[model samples]
Target: MGTDKRTIAVRFFGGAGNYANVLERCFTYVLTDNPDEAALFEWVKSNTRATSDDGIRDRLRFLEAIGLLTVDEDRVALTERGIEWMADTEPKLLFDALAENVRGFETALEALLDEPKTDAELGAAIADEHPETGWSDPSGPAQHRGWLQSLGYVERSDGTNSLTDSGRDLARRLASDGPALERGKSYTQQELEAAFGTSFGSYIKGISPRTDDDGALSYVIVKAREDGPYGDDLEGDRFTYIGEGVPSKGDQSPTGANTALLEQAEGSTVPVYFFYQPADSSELRYEGLVAVVDARYVFDDDHNRMVYQFTMERLELDHPAEFETIAASVTDGGAASIETADGEESEPALTDDETEFTETQRRVRSGAFASRVKSAYNARCAICGTSRESPAGTVDIEAAHIYPKRDDGRDIVQNGLALCRLHHWAFDAGWLAVSDDYRILVADRPDLEGYEEFSRLEGEELTLPTTDERRPHATFLAAHRGLHGFEPAAER
Candidate 1:
């Protein structure tokens, strides 16, 4: 019987540094040229400076240990999956192979179908499945869950876990489809180790840290419109980054590269940095380290096909300079000045003096405030009282500012309300306004195209936040009402 998976893994990755390459090379050699096991064993011993076959056999055994090889007598062969492994360049596939060796993965996956389960509960089932091993330990389920999540097969909210769309798809595929590993080949690199049988190994590189084919870190840059995508409470921190078009033109979801990344990003931290291109700039600004949180499938109207959307979470970096860099990048352009102002640089351009806020501050505040308001409101669009999931696969609510930040509006939840696109645009255009009493106020536009819809909304009470402290600030609502010549209601 093969050794314990944990032990095999520990030894496989652990031995002499140079020897680690042997198995991968050996696998590659087999794929490139079918060779006998005796010949491969001699090849390993010759290079390893060993007189006996024991060391090479142990190495071969370890490979067999991970379900990567099959050895019968003097013949060595890579399983169908092993053949695909040579050219396949994805780490998730590596994880999938590794996960198969983990004892309780099957049981845990099945139990998750009926109801959500906690990591510990899943751990118990794992323990039951692998009674001879320590698969019942907490880490067992957590590790399995991490793989499931990383594979986009599951979603964990709070403490409970449930199957995601990808997870469900995988289950059905497993039931109806043939074995997945036997498909195709990776063709990464090929050459014999100049050995006797060649079955022992080849000289190609094994898995490296997740990176582009050229070894550079990968990144996703998104575009945010000034008043639209980016604002004081939303669209900067964790937004869907894509354009609706063909692969080269900005349609990211349909692009094959991004879809694979979205899968790897789930459950796993980012393998590359993330950046954002502001509405007007030609250069990209570093956002921060991010994790691909989830994927949503939606029809791309422009592409006229269903596309994948990747959602990401921004992680705090260690240094303050990172944020400073982002701030400077956003405010990159300079202006002519007649004279320097007191306690300020000599630039003549109006600072926050006119807009009452700088673009830099607005960007910094938008991401945080947006997350807060959405969390506070449970990600519901306040105006329509309905769920709005965007085609980008994110919560489709906009954290509309009760008072325009341009007018020195506060970036607080009380100064924000989550609105869908229609209401947000209407409010911004002064076509619809909210009263100080949290009531909807549509301007009596006699000739507007959608006059009847506005008429229907004339007295609809706004969806208020759960706590009074977080409710729309009465003063801010009054200011918004004041902008459109509507009377402010009496104070509470």
Candidate 2:
């Protein structure tokens, strides 16, 4: 049989010198001043009576032990608790930190509620109440009494000590309600539904985007796999998501769940919650709120099709500590009962068909179309005949779609043009268009900064392919010209 050892909740060191006020002062200084290790040590030495270097270090360690500060090798900074204490410098804040972190802090204080007791009496009570701490030393009890006295929770009357008015109230509250810091509890999918009144049955795959009752997008839940078809990149706090589609099929389109995610782009009212499962654990971790900063379509390889890639940034929330329940809901099971801004559980409208990847094989056909267009132009820009070759012997050319894929453009060689980076940008920006007679139609903006360069190529005939079947189609050229507000350069 294996033996189990009781773990100590918190370590309470005696001779920490100063009280809560001194700790708060130090915390405020560190937060506002942003001091380094030397600066903090010097300040603590000068401000407080801890003159020796070891004494200053001990004070800093005590602050860290109480969860007020985090002392790194090079820097010393305030923790979340320390920052909160600065905002609300109440005795209860200090009391909360003490009660949670320090062993027998409440036990000693509660013992003095009815009558006054000396340090020895409080020590006896703490030892009896919390024998796991094994605090046989007298310093442990003296330290607790000193901290309570400094916090004004307990006052010494002659030889004995008793709880103050505020101390008695806090002790009673601790006994009845316990500490304010509520630990997170992990629950299954059924339990989350019981708590928040929502169903997550539909969003079991890659991207699960849902709408509210009013037909407006509510929230999006993205399930990222570590070894999935689409590789999701996590750099720092930003997660770059590849739009929905499998590799065996075609490229990903901005439709279904992909469109739902795009709808919540930057300024949209919809909230997006990211959940990912690590390789080691079976649980899915809820990575708080994320806002989609960017979304664009790009083609990376000849084997793959153009896909919409979105960059999402994790937003800093006001009350991050309150995310314990949400975290548990996502991690325990692959479901989350999200709370809206108004603190109400939103019943997001989700259907099985809405999130299905019903995209056609257009991407598969589009990749072949791009290859034919580039090969027709001999891997050179048709406008300027600029054939840029990389050091790796790969030609730099993009197969530009005359009618964009977003507008249901057919992925045929007749609707594509092979252009270099500069002309591709100009064509996409509506600064250039194609005519029916294979001539370049510039936007004719002479007043623009880079208009002269483009205007020179206005009447230049586009480089045509030897095969008539691979040539730019007149219908697609007319669509491009009409879309860019350009008249035909030549008559039939």
Candidate 3:
């Protein structure tokens, strides 16, 4: 073995799909149970589905490859990093171990940031970048993608794979210790503080979008939850984030986080990092380095109070050409609106032309196309027969384009499937597809972590509509299969 380059090999482990939790349990067992080599094998066989002692040894070798464990002829023990992981058991500790010890781990993740890549393309990029790994064919890319998938770093969609928000954050963090610049990635509070080299002061009471002592804007954090009391809207990939202030309170003053963001709209040079925490989770996702395109105070009927709202553009993502033209108009002269303390309105930020532009670009999808597909499938997921209906009589079923609208696929019923959110995302991501014979076809990469459930759905018949005309067209299905690389049963 080369002393510098980490060797690439195929090592199978029974409970590796969710390796972090699985390894944490295994480490705890080793520490408390105090099992010797033979006793450990017996414990693994009893506790997990590991059927043989050889398979358990393979798992040990896999751990050893990542520098988490050491296995001798008669003894096994955790390394210093492994012991640290055992103490904390955070997923980042394990991920850090992989990046430091395993060659190409960071590179493999960074490759997915640009766009989705096929497994072969992803592997080839890693092998090409770090030639010292000597990785060729089956071993190089497959194991890397699988490990990333297991760790919830990469997600497959629309016939190609890309990094998940968490994975994107990890890739960015590893690439540079400097300020985070990537949009749509996520970071913990601690991670953000480390990246910025400053404390946020306080998340509970202090104003978000914290300002430095010199009054330079640090970053903006939004609790942008859909179900939250405050309203936040997204259009053309731009977010209209609610400014700081409680809804139950009287009219909000343009102060604290709100003022920090307003200064950007008023022509500040500093780039603002936009972070959002969902209603369900504490993880603050980085929206991007944002520019405040528009900001204003508006009356909220629901909360019966006046609040400041900032319309932000994620600098990295594309926007409509017309919006760019309108933005130039706003930047040239139009002043952002604000309500004075005496309850008077100021000059509106958006001109009449800009308002008309926003209205025109508000919705791009056809409601009729969505309705027809859902009605055809009885508003249920074609794969799982799942349907989500709120008490307000609205269903959560989504209409998926079989051949994809971006490729000029039509909005007709034959090219659509009414699916639940999970199936819709899965189908779009190439994790699952439907065969010509109306059977479900899952991606065959079982080496990927957390693939067991999806793998089990392979070859399961799809739930089709009653009439032939309403069914998914064969041409469209074939196109989807070709896009996702799903071969027919005979080919397998």
Candidate 4:
């Protein structure tokens, strides 16, 4: 039974670590002969010398935490999910398959799962495993680990680890067939140019995926004088006009000066060019022109349904007379009529009046105060080095106040540090705190065993902002330490 079970265990985990090996062995032992704690502990002790009784207990606890096993008094049994997960040939395979379907993280993940190491361990191992694959940085493995963990391919507990059922299935699927290589498939610039033509290629320069809709993108091209209604005078306007072409909701509209000009030209039925000159500048350059298009032939891009391209058959260079008529009509004739007849008596000053603050005003005031605190901390969270953007763009830290606003701490800039949200909550709840010199401290708790990521953050020096005067207040730190009953040495 032991030999058969060992064979089954090896087949189930497929060259995993000591903890995984132990769990499989335990499950096999339990299924073959229902063992009590004493018997199970003895079996584990004899099988793996690297794990102590306490280590074994912790491993079991970790498994229970992950819903793989359950313990009642001294007896332990495999969970139905755990039993099914172990019995399955390819547990992590589904995650790999899904990851393969997406371009970004799956390739790195497939490589990592091929070996059964924890993220940190896997990151360290990647250099040795595939030194020739060009991704030699230590962060490569770390990022892969984070990606896999985020995607639920791997589960970790108290420094021990196990492959999630999804990860197992993914592995099996990849083993049977070949691993997906979606990351290797991307369109090159030359390929794109060949496929879409030069004009279409130029259109994609400012194109981006539309925020409000799925399956649609947006393109904002700089329209030349030959393309739209304006000419040399309005050429330099940064926001030539604001328009939205929504396909899903079926709402399309053009607005601003362009729309106004387009409406004026509709009366004459003639193509016209429009131009606006800055009062301060004398430079004249061709801007945009409006030309009649065969409405039947205009076709929008498949990727960005909002953008349309039409064939230009003829070029016309004159402004329609209706433009001048419309412009003159809307020129505020009343203002032109009101001649300032040499300094008429001015109106008297209005008296100051008391007013109640609206809810929006109150919130705005609160946000303003929070901004001041965040500025004081130089837009960085004091506990962790989380900034607006990491060098790699992975972590984004936010501004957080050390003292709660309800506790009478002023919402001034002096009270805030830019911290990641997690660290902000930790600092507020007293699970963590900063020293006068801005060093980090963590509360002592055994149950936070799995929180190695957070635990490793303690005692690390904070990355101060560029300004020297924006340092955290010593008075605030002293008061906090006094209230919390813990103090650390100050920074040099």
- For model 2, the stretches where C-alpha displacement exceeds 4 angstroms are 1-18, 177-492
**Who wins the TM-score comparison?**
3
lDDT per residue (tens digit) for residues 300-397 in model 1 = 66555555655665555432333333323221122222334565545222223444434434554455466566656777778787765555445567
After superposition of all CA atoms, the RMSD between model 1 and the true structure is: 20.8
lDDT values for all models: 0.55, 0.65, 0.65, 0.43
The TM-score of predicted model 3 comes to 0.38
Q: Whose TM-score is higher: candidate 1's or candidate 2's?
A: 1
RMSD of each: 20.8, 22.6, 22.0, 28.9
Q: Estimate each model's TM-score.
A: 0.35, 0.35, 0.38, 0.27
Where is model 1 more than 4 Å wrong at Cα? 1-272, 275-360, 490-492
2 against 3, candidate with superior TM-score: 3
TM-score ranking from best candidate downward: 3, 1, 2, 4
TM-score, structure 2 vs. true: 0.35
Deviation in angstroms for 390 in model 4? 13
Predicted candidate 2 versus true structure: per-residue lDDT over 166-229, tens digit per residue: 6776676556421121113333445433432457683356787766679765566676777777
For residue 335, give model 3's deviation from the true position in Å: 26
Give the higher-TM-score candidate: 3 or 4.
Answer: 3
How does residue 355 of candidate 3 score in lDDT? 30
Q: Candidate 4's residue-wise lDDT over 373-419, tens digit each? A: 45455556666555654321222545454455555543334455667
Model 2, position 300: C-alpha lDDT score? 43
